[model samples]
Target chain A: MRVITGREAVREALREEMQRDENVFIIGEDVGVYGGAFGVTGNLIEEFGEERVRDTPISEAAIAGAAVGASLLGMRPVAEIMFMDFVTIASDQLMNQGAKIHYMFGGQQNAPFVMRMPAGAAEAGAQHTQSLEALLYHIPGLKVVMPSTPYDLKGLLKTAIRDDNPVMFVEHKKGYGEKGEVPEEEYTIPFGKADIKREGKDVTIIATSHMVFKALNAAETLAEKGVDAEVLDPRTLVPLDMESIVKSVSKTGKVVIVHEAPRRGGVGGDIAARISDSEAFYYLEKPIKRVTGPNTPVPFSPVLEAEFIPSEEKIIDAVMKLTK
Target chain B: MELSEAKKLKMYRDMWRIRQFERKVDQFISRGDITGTTHLYIGEEATAVGAINALKDEDYISSTHRGHGHAIAKGSDIKEMMAELFGKRTGACKGKGGSLHIIDTSTNNLGANGIVGGGIPIAVGAALALKMQNRDEVVLNFFGDGAMNQGAFHEATNLAAAWNLPVVFLCENNQYGMSTSIEKAFKIKDLAKRGEAYGIPGVRVDGNKALEVYDTVLEAAKKARNGGGPSLIVSETYRWKGHSKSDAKVYRTKEEEEEWKQRDPIADFEQILIEQNLLDEDKIKEIKNEVDAEVKEAVEFAKESPYPDKDEIFDDVYVDREVEL
Candidate 1:
């Protein structure tokens, strides 16, 4: 085992994937000699050469379209849009073409492309800080994965690279430098399998991305107060591990789904509905709770932004309400 | 550098095929044999035929909503194309892409796009792949005059020029984008001049003249194949029908319509072939008969093709069965 940051995990995945497959190359702005904007791809071009680590012009549409075309002609291209906001410019290629090519063509062609967008709030204001994974999650034919830890990032990134369908692998910018122990061997984590971070009998906390960290912290706080909270981290949102969530909720008799995206139409609502509609609903003692960001743009100010994202205090409050 | 008599004659026949096929498609759409609306390429036949005829079979091309002409010119089978437009099970896209989205990977047509300026970057991408693979194949991307105003066009051209990717941007300036006239849509009088900003050669030509458009576009295609980078060729053409079957000629004057009609590409090419002594009247009549019979057969094939099975819907979502791409 080796200690690696989320950024290093990403870099290792790129290196390993590029080494295993010649057709796999990365193209994006500032992804080459300048490294990535977040340093996830630092020093990769030196190891792989300029051809494999392509630094493209600041044209998101062109970069995305080129990836799609190259994918069509037998290339596994991973495109990194500097910020999640920049994905708007390439929405046509991603939503219209990338997401619909297989279905529209009646399954004749496979769009084996991965678009990595560094998303989530960092007090960077309305545009740069928005966690827009919900927008992509709404689109069909796209697999959405968000890894909160270094080990999960490495494992999931490997799975995403080997997967033969188009994937939107979103990375929270704040989670990049966070370190965790990752095994020094090649292994891919199966998608749609939720990890039970902590087991408890009081409440089931289903969270994603950075919210997983928040949930784990909240669990620690709850433990001090004699409340054992079960924390579940769903690495992927598209092919959600609803079974695991339902099973956990069944044992605990209460659940709270948490995410950083706005509460309206967030993944939490879907999880809540799944639990309510399933056999797990009979065991529930209280209504399922959903803790999410406010229904507004991410604020630039640190104080307001803190209020916007779900925090340990908020999770503790919600858990206390259910336990009381 | 002149096109041979046989090639020029062949080009004329191809333009006629587009005209007749489009007219038939319009009729089929009106009769409800085809479910959706269609953008006819009847008036702009010469532009697609003239430009695509300059390319070899291995060369690539991207088309727009008004794309049947380009598909036929690039050698897509008329039967499968007709079925595709009709949304039949045996259609080029297996009934998934009706009318505006006919795609045939076999001919390297790269599918027609529904969005304006959508194919520009795709063409550039294909060219980039070709350059990286050290292939001599050139990509021809066709769009309308209205698409010239889109940012994708400017960005794609700039990137293509910077990297010296092998591509030719063929703009079929048929006067209007839907109901919006090019005069109202753009400030630049000559669409080809837009390429000057990217430091590439640009040419404006009479799209109705098959030989002229063919020769000019042939030169551009040759330059691309030889690694001379991208060129923008603006073909001044006209659409014979409304933008789609739903449109009425409310935007332009009837006199303007009559004036463009007088320059009918098929008629003009037929006269050129005859006056140049490339074809006798009997041979011209025979070619017309052959084109008509072929179109009829295509419509019949589309009518007879079966719809896809329900289970087929889940088949091609991912290349591999267990993993998503």
Candidate 2:
């Protein structure tokens, strides 16, 4: 076992996958000698050569489109968009081309690729900041994955590379520096499985990405208040682990879904709806609560940006509202 | 000049086939047989035939909205192409892809895209894939001057040259981008010269002359296969018909249309072959009859084919069944 930062875990996972399969290669802006915009691909060029760790021009559409074509033709191409906001520039390729290719071609062809990008408001302005998981995952053919811990990021990314489907591996700009335990031996975490980060009884808090840590912190605080909150992290959104979610809800009799994305059409809303839809609905003692970013864009001001992201206090407030 | 007699015959057949296919499509659409929008390749026969002829069946091609010629020239069966347009279940893409999205994976035709310049990036990726595997394959991306303004063109061009990927950017300069003339859209006349920005070679050829386009593309393909990187071949051509069957000739004059019509690619190529003793009147008549019959049967097949079943609509999205679907 080894302790590593989330950033190191990403690089290690890429390195291991590239070693395991020659068909797997990385391509994106500054992914080469520059080591990626966030240094997630550190020194990979030196080991894998420029061909495997290719540097692309500032063309997000081409980057995504090329990934689609490469994957369709039997190569596993992992493309990186510098920021999630820029994913809009490559949306046609991702949504129209990558997502629809498999179905449009009658299963005769598909683009097995991974589109990696850092999302959420990380003190970045309106243009560079966005949490697009809900928007992208809503597509029928795409798999949306958000890894909270170092071990999960490494394991899930490896799985994404191996899967014969297109996956959007979304990361948080702030989470890369966080450290966690990761085994040196190879492993993978299957999609649609929920991780019970903490066990409890009073209430359940369903969270993803940055919100998972926020909910864990809220759970710790709630424990002192005798609330005994359970924290559930559903790593993959497309293949949602409703089994674990509904089970937790049935046990706790209350639920609070947390996410950094907008509340209007975020995955949190879907999770809440599913909880109400399941047998857990009869077990519920209180209405479902959601801690989310407002419908407005993540602003430029520090105070505004801080308020835009859901805090531990917000999570605790939501949990307290449901539990009380 | 170095083309064998058999190759010459193929070149003539391909060019003639595209022209005849498009002619039938227009007639079908006019008679209310074929519904939906279509961008015909009536005058741009040589560009597709010549460029596609220079490519092997294994070599990939990405075509534009006006891509029937490229598809037919790439040896796509007229039956499936017509079936696709007719929205029949027996189409190349199984009816999901109508006229704008005809695909023939058997020949490495990666479907014609509806979005202008959309296919170029896909072609660049195909080339990048070959380059990654050390596979000796080249990609021919056919677009138009209309696509000249599309972000995809610039992005694909830059990526192709930057990676030294084996791809040829074949621009079909039909002088108009859906009624807006190329001169109005660009300051420069030679669309091939745009490749200079990416540090690649760019050359324009007479698109009406199938052999000339074939020669240019052949040279470009050889360069690509040898790892010489990408080149831009601008085939200066015209769209003798309107952009589609829906278009009216309000933007240009009848005089200009007639002027370009006199230099029809089929007539010009037929005369060239006759003078070179590669074709005679009897041989020409036989080829014409064969082409006409093939197109006629293709239309009849398309008309007789069944529409896709309602349940089949749910199929083809994901091979592994990403979800319960």
Candidate 3:
């Protein structure tokens, strides 16, 4: 086992996957020489050479289009959108062509590629900071992944690269510096499985991406107040871990969903609605609450952005209210 | 490109077959047997047959909404295509994709696009894959004149030129975009000149003349296969009917329509066949009857085919959905 940051874990995953399959290649803006915008794909070009680690022009649509075409023909292309906000440039390509090709052609096509996007707020202004997991989850064929730890990032990312489907690996920009122990041996994490970060009986805290750490913090703070909280991290949202979520909810009989995205029309609402629809509804002791950002763009100001994000205090207060 | 006598007759026969098929589809739509609307390929038979007839079936071709002629020319089954139009379980896409998205995997005909320039990027991507695989195959992408204005065209073309990918961007300029005149859209009469933007060779040919399309595409295909990169070929044709079944065709004049009808691709090809002594009048009549019977049987087959089951509606969305949540 080795300790590495989420960024290095992702690079290792790409390096290992490329070595495993000759058809696997990397394509995006500045991925070749510049080592990716966030330095996640550093030295990949040196190891794999330029042809395999292609540095495309600043064309998100072209990158997505090329990835879609290349993957359909059995070549695994790992495309990177510089930021989640910029994915709008290629949304049509992903939403329309990449998502519907197989079904529209009667299963004659397969878009087996991974699009790595650095998402969520990282002191970047409104244009650069946005969590688009909800939009991606709404699309049927596109698989959505948001890993919180180095281990999960490597395992899940490798799986995404290998699967014969289009997967959006949305890495949290803040989570890149977060360190975790990853196995030296190769491994793959299956989707739709939730990790019980902490097990308790008072309330179930369902957190995603970077919010998992805050939820963990809240659980620790809740322990002091005699309110035991359970933190569950659902790594993949599309192939969601409903069974695990309901199991946690059933154990606790109360749930709180935490995410950095806005509350009005976000993925948290989907999870809350699903829990209400599932067998967990009868087990709920209190109504589900969402601790999320407001329905507005992330501000450029540091104080305002900090206030915009869901804090551990907010999570703890929500848990305390449910416990009371 | 020199063609044998048999090959030349086959080209005429394919063009005739496409015309008959389009006519049958029109009759079916009018009679309410075929559902939904279609962008008919009535006057552009020569453009499709001339291009696809010269390329190998393994070579990929991305088509536009008016795709039946391209499908037929690229060796798709008329029955499956007709069944798809009828929305049947026996359809090419199992009734999932209708007339605008017909696809035949047997001949590697990529599914047609509903959006104007959507298939352009897809074709470029396919060519990139071919290059990456070190395969000698080429892609022949078909779009209308109006799609040239789409951003997808520019991005795909620029990338194709930069990467030196093997693709032929074949434009069927039928002079209108759902009743909007091409002249109103662009100032250039020869739309192929747009290829200069990417620094690739662009050629224009009389679309009503099928042989010209065949030779031009054949040359492009050879150049692409020999690492000459991509080229754009614009076949200047005219749409004889409305864009779809609902088109009023108020944009063009009756005089203009009559002038184009005088150069009907199928009729002119028939005349050429007779003058070349390759097909006598009796032989011409026999081929026409054969094609008529073939299209007629396709309609019959589509009529007999069943609509897809409702259970399959959710299937094929993904390769696997596991247990539904």
Model 3 TM-score (B-chain only): 0.98
- Model 1 chain B: ten consecutive residues of lowest lDDT: B316-325
TM-score of chain B of 1: 0.96
Model 2 lDDT vs. the true structure?
0.88
TM-score to native of every candidate shown: 0.96, 0.95, 0.98
By TM-score, the best candidate is 3
Q: By DockQ, is 1 or 3 better?
A: 3
Best by lDDT: 3
lDDT ranking, high to low = 3, 2, 1
Per residue, candidate 2 scores C-alpha lDDT tens digits across B1-325 of: 4878898898898877888888888887898888887899988888888888888779999988898888887778899889988989998888887788887778888878888888888889999999888998899999888887989888989989988899999999988888899879999877777889999999999999988998999999999999999999899889998988779979999999998999898888888899999899899999989999999999899989999999997787666654644
Off by over 4 Å in 3: B323-325
In candidate 3 the C-alpha lDDT for residue A302 amounts to: 96
Number of clashing pairs per prediction, in order: 6, 2, 0
Error of 2 at B123 (Å): 1.2
Q: Which ten residues in a row are the worst by lDDT in model 3 chain A? A: A101-110
Model 1, position B66, has a per-residue lDDT of 90
> Tens-digit lDDT track for model 1 on A59-176?
9998888777667667888999999889999988888877777767656666788899998998689999878888888887888899899989989988888887788999999889
Chain A, candidate 3, TM-score of 0.99
Q: What's the DockQ for every one of the candidates?
A: 0.49, 0.65, 0.68
